[model samples]
Target: MRCAPSAGAALVLCAATAGLLSAQGSPAQPEPPRFASSDEVNLLAHGLLQLGHGLREHVEHTRGRLGSLERRLDACGAACAQASGTAAPPPAANPVVGDAAAPETLRNLQVQLKAQDTRIEQLFEKVAQQQRNLEKQQLKIENLQSQVRLLAPSHVEHKVIKPARGKRLPKVAQDGDTAHNASRLHRLPRHCQELFEEGERQSGLFQIQPQGSPPFLVNCEMASDGGWTVIQRRQDGSVDFNQPWEAYKAGFGDPQGEFWLGLEKVHSITGNHGGRLSVQLQDWEGNNESLQFPVHLGGEDTAYSLQLTAPVASKLGATAITPNGLSLPFSTWDQDHDLRGDKNCAKTLSGGWWFGTCSHSNLNGQYFHSIPRQRQQRKKGIFWKTWRGRYYPLQATTILIRPAVDASAS
Candidate 1:
């Protein structure tokens, strides 16, 4: 490559050496221009490939002159030997006064040669550095391509599926309807308490997506204190609560009226972030009472078991209530998860519940408009035994939950 400065250097070296050896006076040569910096050296490499031909011609002319001077010196020595039989005086001793600056000129030429060589080496180094940088950039691009290939399949598998407008959402099957509902999750609240905090004062139906669960519609009960998510209600005999395992597991009914929010959804809400459960009951005589408990409901593997702490608040007057059914797994007519061995509490009481040797409170029991005169028939009606006897059926009942307002939840 012309990157090497050898050609220009040969010209300078040849001219300088010839001037010194002949002990001859020559006109001072102009100094070659030097590179300002390494960057300029690179720019020159692109503009020009070879040193100037005029410089080469000048070096050849100097070499020829030096050869002529050598011949004349040889002839003069021969002539002196014949006349006085003595050798000619050494050329250095007979040096002309005009040749005094030959050594200095040679030194300057040598310095210029060395400088050009250094600039060429620097240019070579810069090229190598740029090549290394390009190689590193290529490696980075390859790594990113590999990552994209690894993640491509997952992107296709989990692609968000938007539901058709003006249609009810399909039932939770695989991923619990997460694929179709995920698009709306960002706009929907996670629970009724979140809605109340967002300044929703009116009680109505709203879509919610609990953590790890798909979005679904629920009725929000907006009270003065906060909002409550209504999970189950028995206002009228509109929706039957006497269902098997699958019906309760998948939930049934509407949010505007009486409905039971599915067991899986209740687990999603209460299991991840615990909640406070409130049971409100009204007797046929219009006597209303309520009870509150800090609760956590388990998942389907645990039969959606209920876990309740002591009642934090109760309006049962002086009634001594024992929360016996709090720790039991839920039971249904088909799949018995209750503790009772001989008879399924769900079959005996004609409804579903978390029952241990039967229940003290059976909210899912059959709705009775009036008090049953037969003692056996009363056990089939909705009853909270502490406030009212088992035979007295309730007029209306609501089961709601609000996120726990403790430090752990925060």
Candidate 2:
């Protein structure tokens, strides 16, 4: 093999070096300390800067290791080439000539070379994993830095806010827009909220306190059946889920169709809307299943909103499913095959997680991307009894509305 110069590796090394230097030590020196209104917040900035420097040190260490590994790899390649170039000795004139054993020197060298090759391969994998870990850590430190910036007076801002319940959305019902259901009622029962609102971030399991009382804990999980599933905490950090199976079975609390993953709710509105529902998820991998048609509660006159979005229009669009049991096409995404939400009602008392038949479905001359493309991948009409009887129609994008309470008067 011919040896060729590679600029790629050189570029990677340069970038890694530069990144480490910039993160660890700034070229400029700091001026004398000035007092700040919030000393704690100012200290936070200082602490974060220190942490950033430490993270930069860690990065430099990893890059140094990477550089070392690259050199070793290059050396291995050179050695391998040299070995290949030194052709094996021509067949001995006499097969028995080796009876005297032509010095085992070459033989040991070959063995050593093979062992080194194996070691190099192992090192490559190790270095790759290390690089990934370093990248992930750097990302975490950067996020911390972002948080620190939030402490700076120039970086922070204050804003007034109106209540969300009465707010008018940009797109009218006729214009095809919706409001998803979510909330921040910390005082509500633990079984009511699916996520915790921590100032800005929402986490799957979080701690919340209201009215200066003790903090309560909650864990979130999406069920096929509507209502909330909590990771209730015991006196210790242990958790329990004493929920009934019905609340979790397919076609009940979960999304109406196939999903990559699903959630019970996204609280934007504070009130108990109609028909408590489950989440439906989707992604690149396919999920073929029947889908549940949207079911609204209360009379037709009640005000309702939805929040839905998808790739592009080539597929179907995000939609608002009403309890009235009507199939309404709302929006479009990515050409036509991007995202489609077509409603399907169970004609036979039988269905699944979302609720729809499994099979090839062409969306009005458009493509519908999904998985489980086999006959068995069908959402239902068959084995839903084994796996909850609810199948989500792949065509059903998703539904977002505050679930309606079964006990609430319509």
Candidate 3:
């Protein structure tokens, strides 16, 4: 093996190489940059400041809208409270008192109140949405401020700017939405529930029965599914009988809608007896109008439907003969009367009251004509003529259907 160079000789050679390299004069390396330039930092800060100002303006505008909605809501609440506090006038001592116009006035007032309530509810929803947007804008402004602080130069003094304050937003009306969803899962769809609520508020109380029969009170309530429920209540407020009726908004002019009453309830109350049923409506003007329809069982179950069309002048005069010898003007469309075989009772009629099968027949009148003309018939009473030649008074329930109206409008 070759011997290694001695330590003193290696050190002398390294020193000579360093001195030669220094004499050549190589350039020195520069240090890398750690921060952005002053101009770039200033530009970024300016952009952040503009965004912050825009957010502040938006927040102020939203607050103004929120305040307006709250004021409207307060007004609606006052109107609703006033409506509920007013009591209905007491009934006249006379059972046959007439107030035809009062009913209509009361109905209109109720409709207006309902409309106001609905408008308030819509405003509440809008306010809640605006509040959520305001929160998001605030958060954005905060983020922009943080970025500005990071980019700000050390020599430049930075001051924090606070957002303007406003009134606290009311809690959102989540209960209505939750209840609406829950109702759909169990009872009725959203549209139907609205119909039912409106109908309940608009229905009127009436006394209904067949000719010569004892009158029974029928309370009408609108179902959630846009149907009518007629119930007879006892003195203790318990229901005696109940009937379901379906109503559709059809026709034009005087008669605006139609109500369908099934034959099952008629059969239950009158049995094999046959006669005409009368519905007494007390108007706001203290005048009472009687709506009459023929109900003959004919030993079979058949459905009966009535049209809400204007009554013909010729038929109205003939049907206006009431038992009390008073002739009231017939304004409503009469029920369609049609006979199948020996079934002399009225079947379902289409279009106008006089447009059906019994148009030319002897029973073409508003009330049916039995074989014996001597039978006593009263327009305001419920009387049923049985096959055994005996007349019995009926106190039964009847369901009336009308077209579904908007809860707010109705």
Summarize candidate 2's per-residue lDDT along 1-410 as a digit string, tens digits. 00011222433554576587456554467756544334444454454445444444544454455456445544454444455544445565321222322334335544554554454445445445655655565566566655444322121222212222111212222222233312222233223232212122222322333222333332333344432423111111111111222222211221112221112222212233433433343323345333333233321122123221222111222234343332221111211111223533222222222222212221111112343455433442222222233232233233333334432222
TM-scores for all candidates: the values are: 0.51, 0.24, 0.18
* Candidates arranged by TM-score, highest first: 1, 2, 3
Model 1 earns a TM-score of: 0.51
- Candidate 2: misplaced stretches above 4 Å? 1-20, 31-129, 132-394, 397-410
lDDT of each: 0.64, 0.32, 0.32
Count the clashes in each prediction.
0, 76, 28
Candidate 2 lDDT for residue 59: 41
Better of 1 and 2 by lDDT: 1
Q: Write down the RMSD of candidate 1 (Cα, Å).
A: 29.7
Model 2 TM-score on a 0 to 1 scale:
0.24
lDDT of 3 by residue, 1-410 (tens): 01112222333443564566455444355456345444544554454445434433543444455456445544455444455545544554221122222444444645654554454445445445544655565566567665554343211112332211111011232554555344333221112123344233333332233223333322334334443433111111122111112221121111111222233333333444333334433222344344444433332223233222233222333333334332111111232234233332222211222122222211111222222234343221222221111222223213232322332132
lDDT score, candidate 2, position 175: 22
How close to the true structure is residue 136 of candidate 3, measured as C-alpha lDDT? 67
Worst 10 residues of 2 by lDDT: 232-241
